[model samples]
Target: MNFNRKQYTEDDLLALYRGILLPRLIEERMLILLRQGRITKWFSGIGQEAISVGATLALNPDEYILPLHRNLGVFTGRNIPLDRLFAQFQGKTTGFTKGRDRSFHFGSKEHHIVGMISHLGPQLAVADGIALADLLDRKQKATLVFSGDGGASEGDFHEALNVAAVWGLPVIFMIENNGYGLSTPNSEQFKFASFIDKGPAYGIDTLQIDGNNVLEVYDTVRQAAASIRQNPRPILIEAMTFRMRGHEEASGTKYVPQELFEKWVKKDPVENFEKYLLDEMVLTSRSQVAIREELKSLIEEGLDKAFAVPMPEPNVAEELADMYRPFAPALITPTSPNTTEKRFVDAISDGLRQSLEHYPELVIMGQDIAEYGGVFKVTEGFVEQFGKQRIRNTPLCESAIVGIGLGMSVKEKKSVIEMQFADFVTSAFNQVVNNLAKSHYRWGQNADVVIRMPTGAGTAAGPFHSQSNEAWFFHTPGLKIVYPSSPYDAKGLLNAAIADPNPVLYFEHKLLYRSVASQIPDEYYTLEIGKAKLVTEGDDISIITYGMGVHWATRLLQTMPEVSADILDLRTLLPWDQEAVAQTVKKTGRVLILHEDTLTGGIGAEISAWISENCFNYLDGPVIRVASLDTAVPFSPPLEQQFLPVQRLQEKVAQLLKY
Candidate 1:
């Protein structure tokens, strides 16, 4: 094969040859370990190492690369220790993730690599966010993200491309078209002649090349990197290759035809690259044989060392807990006392303003968040003040945008993402529940992002717009859920959520935006997350509620002179104040859990269950729950009112008092 000597020297070609040889040798060793029951699984990149090595070498050392399971050559090209890779496969404590994750799901901050989850498509959006940070910092760095042909069929793939195109981010979306997505062939995946053909529709440059040829892949990526650094636009490259093995070591190649397997074997990237190096006189036959022997010895040594490493202790869970400990309250210089009264919407806006002024790395993004200042106007004038660099307006891709926030958070940039409506959060549910909430536990990385959700009912916005969806996230651990009912709490908790080191679901009631008002301090302060407020002290009964339900309970309490109920506003739902609830329940000897969310599987049920378990003897009556009927919010006023009837709440309270 002809090569470009100017683009790559003999030394570079030899290194690329080593890159191809190392992964193949390591896979053979790992397969031995798998058979010996020392390792659980193996995802080999036997015939596709050329693409990973070439692409990694094409970018700057400091540039980021998010690799999928099959890109082991990228790790080798980055000079990550072979023993560390073996340690991860063995689930030893010396692994990249400290034995928290297995297989190829590990990354290094020092190497500028973000570890990937099994859901392959979300990383593209995350790469976009990394590029956004580089652009904001005015740096000349680009991010390379790898995904399989099967992952391209996911919605996140298209959403990521759309966002990258619209923002003109410096990202390279590299697709490893290895002919098959697990057991499914590429013929059934899509109808496009080539994956690169779709790049034009997304306004991105495209390229398709022989992935087995190291020189060709390297030259193409090097040129693409130069253009991207100057122009800052996304590029799509589809590298044609083949997976020599099945998806994993255990998954045999029975589905693969013998002819196709044999054909790929003939064009094996490692063997072909070695032959090219020998043909070009870059390496002699003797040197090539020595290199293969050296790689085999190195693999054996790495496996030996990794086998001696200790497994993670059971107390490693405690270490994980310590790593994910709640962030302490932020210290702030109060400019003024609580002398200024403000509405809920103004309070939220002021909180955002304070956050932007305090944390320079704090970024706010959502649909119409930049120029339009969001649909609810909570972020009005923010783009003008903070500029579009920090305050970004994103495409209407909830999953991609949330994924962007997740990526930025992992890179140490705190992000606040707004979902125009709480209901729309369902679109990004996987990113939230799977990626954001489980990031720390899965890979020991914190997703320090706050997702602002405008929620609740009363505007008759119907099922789509009005929803009390806190229950959905409340069930998910590794996420903080905060729903403040008053302006003071809103301003304070929003600041807390932004400063928090964990992912927070900040639920802002849309109905209370204009209706609720309170005196809040002009200066910045963060309310303690997971703590409830004692709105009133009463000896009769305790009413635990959040969001708009707080107002309903308070108003109903005024009408019932015979029932003096202690109103407790649970500002943060996920880690609810058990001590506060216990004290209130002990003092009153009765409790009523109320919420605007539906009756089934509501947070009220959890609170009631806790009270029954912990304060059963203190209770004067059985714990009662008053919530909306188990149905979607209706469009009609009367039906909606009937669904969440105040009269039914009154009757429930009366009945509880009688009990």
Candidate 2:
């Protein structure tokens, strides 16, 4: 039983013993609650407590920890109040997430812990971003991110590791390889001999250890933290262990072999550690018994108090209002009529410049954003002005980059993330739709992040590169979608999005970068996020459009002066100006919604549905929609032009005029 005692003192070993014991006791109580139907579900970490507790114990208290669903030991190690932990499982109003989230989908800003989302792998990239923020602030802190063997199969795992390695970010990617991913064993997951081997490919330091051994796990992580603080590089550690219980309470362990289960039970981390403490004389038999009884009593008291807390009030109206908090009307001072004109791209760059100047904590990250100034040159000269620390050039990892932005925003910093092309945003759809959009609603945590999506088609960029994917996010509730058609609106709205307290998807039309130009003010300004602009005044019909569609509709109206139509440019899509749309429709008595996105399931559908519901009586004719064909953008010049509804808009408007 002899071992090296130089790495940790007797007191440190006793603290580890207590940390491992607390989660084990809590989880056992959780299973009883589940059986009694007091809690809906339970995800046990009975046999894998050492990996979670040991690694967490090695870090500084203020350092961030993004735990996986099964890492109850992490909460214990971080000293998260047991009452709040139990209340969260009971779905009480006093829980960390205010009863909005159950299981591990909750975090504590005070404790510097990012709660786990059901999709655990995305947090790896978020941890990368957090570490990046620390590095920018010149803080010598590291972020510990956890994932299971199954979660490692996700693309986010690789993306996070790559970004962390390339930037030399201080992140520890810990893999709790617990033999199986639910019912599927590691043998079926990957052909690689060990998950640790994959780290070297990303230029990360790698280690594989006996996860069941608490002392070994703590010593390795302690050294890893020290090295990361000194050299600032990402490290991967694969902790070999087993999940003795089922994935969740309802998921029976029938798939596991009896022999395998028996083997792991004998190697139970908590029991094994207690025996080690006793053998090394670090803890007496009496002390071990006392520790167990203390945790049991604490768990019982915490659970009893948590269960007494009232359930959250079901306030649908309040939730809806809180979901999309209205941005204050921007006090836009009138500029001189002879203000200098700037291209759309220049205006966007100016907005970003103003944001960086306004918010000292703002960080801009994307592929080729730093030295290369981004592919579209939207961030040109940012690196020279702000330096690489603020203007980051990340690897080609769309999902992780967005996740990182989400993580950074959790620290009360603002992040403006650019997806090189809007179409590429689909790669990070899960993070956007699930993590970024849902963070605020689930936990009352605002992700003050702006995703600058360079969207739309016109340069014959083909299917993958050319897409107006705004419709994808239009259905998401907690996101603000803004698509500005002109230079003035672009600059104003970009500033507005950065200032908003929630995540905003700012879509910058790719074609308008050089094509559109207008006079804009030099001073800082912001526009209302959900407002619309009346581009042209007419009475016959209302042509509501945004982005490239605005130009198309304006051109069509100019061709037919005999048929007067009001062109209403909807600068924002998600929370479109319903009052303005109703007023315009009631005034004109006819309406036409236009966009570059596909006809089916596009933003047009929502607008059309709204007009039907609210402005039906005022409408003199049926609400019409003129949008791109229901197909991917074609590469050929002729096909691309035909695919979009630009030429067809003239004919559609002619038909609407007759109505």
Candidate 3:
């Protein structure tokens, strides 16, 4: 059979063959190394090289491509140095992630490549954010995101597709259906006949093709890119292919039918493409053998260079230093020429409005936020004031929306993501904890986002709505948590969080929104995120609390004047005011930790342990803690009141004072 040429030249065709050949040769060599114990592990892309290579080549060099584990062609096509890639596989300091993360789990901003996380589906939504940024900037570029039959089952897949269609984003969703998802066949994965049908369901253009055909894959993607440039919208491509090896080097392929392997081996992409090129007179057998020898020598030289590089040193300082970008929370005094009284919700609105005015790259997104002003009316007139482009409403897809915010951050754009209620953030926990929180630590990428969490349990919103889940994120190493008590702190700390370069969870108590008012400055000001405020002064006891607990402590102290106590409002949770806690502990010799979260495994536990360890010598009595009962927040008002620690706090304060 002879080959027919269209837009691409003879040289372009030869380059594509070389692109497919490199990954196959490299993986074959790596498997030998794996047996020799030179490399740790490998996710072989031996068979599906055409999809990664053709799709990457289809887009402009500047456009972004999010590659899956098997897409070695994406790297080699971009001409990334083989030495650096081999070093990354070997977990050396010269790798993209500095050996922080292994395998093809790292991204390179210079190459416009966003690498995949273990959770494959979330990257689809993150691609939306990247495309959204381009749309907002009117850039003529599209994003190509890769997924598989197994990963397509994740909720993020549906959410990302629907959102991309609604927002008119330019993204190419590539699904490589390789028959098995780590031993589970596609037969058990989804009942649907084809992923192509999903495109019409979401109003996106769909294409289905044989993934092994290199020329066909290249032509189809090239046309899709051209269509998106003229009319920006998402396109879904389902490539039917098969992986010859196991999921990883260790997992054997006994689960796969031997007949299936024999059938696919005959239709091998590399061998078939070589045959077609020979028939078309694009190359002779002599040239093909010479090319293989040259590539093998190159791979050997690159492996030698990578092997000579040293491994990362094992030390606390190095580990800690790589965890976060260099950042120092601002500390501004509350002194201003003018001040005004405002409610907690109004203060937050003011801060957001002022931040939008201050930062050109800042955008706010959440459900019911654009026209409806969110569930709480916090952004009542934001859409009109800032326009729809900046203040946008999102579908009820928490995980994808947060992933979108992360994608925007990757392009140096700051985002304020509102989780309608703090409880709903659970749906997006993987994106927040694994992707947003760990992006900077794994690589030198900044996830400049401030997640607004409407929290607390005073309202009768029940178990689903009322949850003070700050403790859930407090344990995460790469995130900052801030829970403000009053309007003044709310406005200041929020601005501070938006300004900080790391991912921050800003918790706003639902009960304090309209009930509490304070005299705040008219102009914008920022307070230190790691700093604590001394609300009241005393000499006998110390009341350490935050959010609604601050108000509870104040009410108890006002009622009992005999108990002269110091009230310390911990405006920030993750980077809590340890210095203030220790100082107050030494001065009073009595400490009472208070919070609205449940008692077991709460933030109070960490504070109590810290006080016990650091201030053990300064203790006059046992460290006391008063927190809500360790159970789901009840729907009944009476039970909720009983479950809360308002009454229990009074008893604990009295006991500590007596001790």
- Top candidate, metric TM-score: 3
Task: Evaluate model 3: give its lDDT.
Answer: 0.91
Q: Identify the runs in model 1 with alpha carbons over 4 angstroms from their true place.
A: 316-326, 331-335
If both were scored by TM-score, which would come out higher, candidate 1 or candidate 3? 3
Which regions of candidate 2 fall more than 4 Å away from where they truly are?
A: 1-3, 324-338
Q: List the residue pairs that clash in candidate 2.
A: none
Better of 1 and 2 by TM-score: 1
Sorted on lDDT, highest at the top, how do the candidates line up? 3, 2, 1
**Rank by TM-score, descending?**
3, 1, 2
TM-score of candidate 2 versus the correct structure, residues matched by position:
0.96
Candidate 2 lDDT by residue in tens digits, 1-659: 12355758889889999998899888887888788899998898989999999998989999999998789988888888888888888888788877778988988888888888898889999899889888888889889999999989999998999989998999999999987898998899999999878977998889998898888888899999999998899999999899988998678899999999888888888888888778889999888889899989988889888988888889888778767545575556546444659999999999999989989999998888988899999888888899988998887889999998988887778999999998889899999999999887777667888999998887998999998889889999999999999999998999989988789999998899998898888877888888999999898999999999889888777778887778899899878899899989999998999999999998888889989998899988889999999998999999999999988887887887777
**Candidate 1 lDDT over residue span 178-255, tens digit each:** 889998998999998898889889989999988887778888888898999999999999999998888987888999
| Model 3 misplaced stretches (Cα beyond 4 Å) | 1-4, 329-336
Select the stronger candidate by lDDT from 2 and 3.
3
Task: Tell me model 1's lDDT, rounded to 2 decimals.
Answer: 0.87
Write model 3 residue lDDT over 182-218, tens digit each, in one string.
Answer: 8999999999998998887899999998898888888
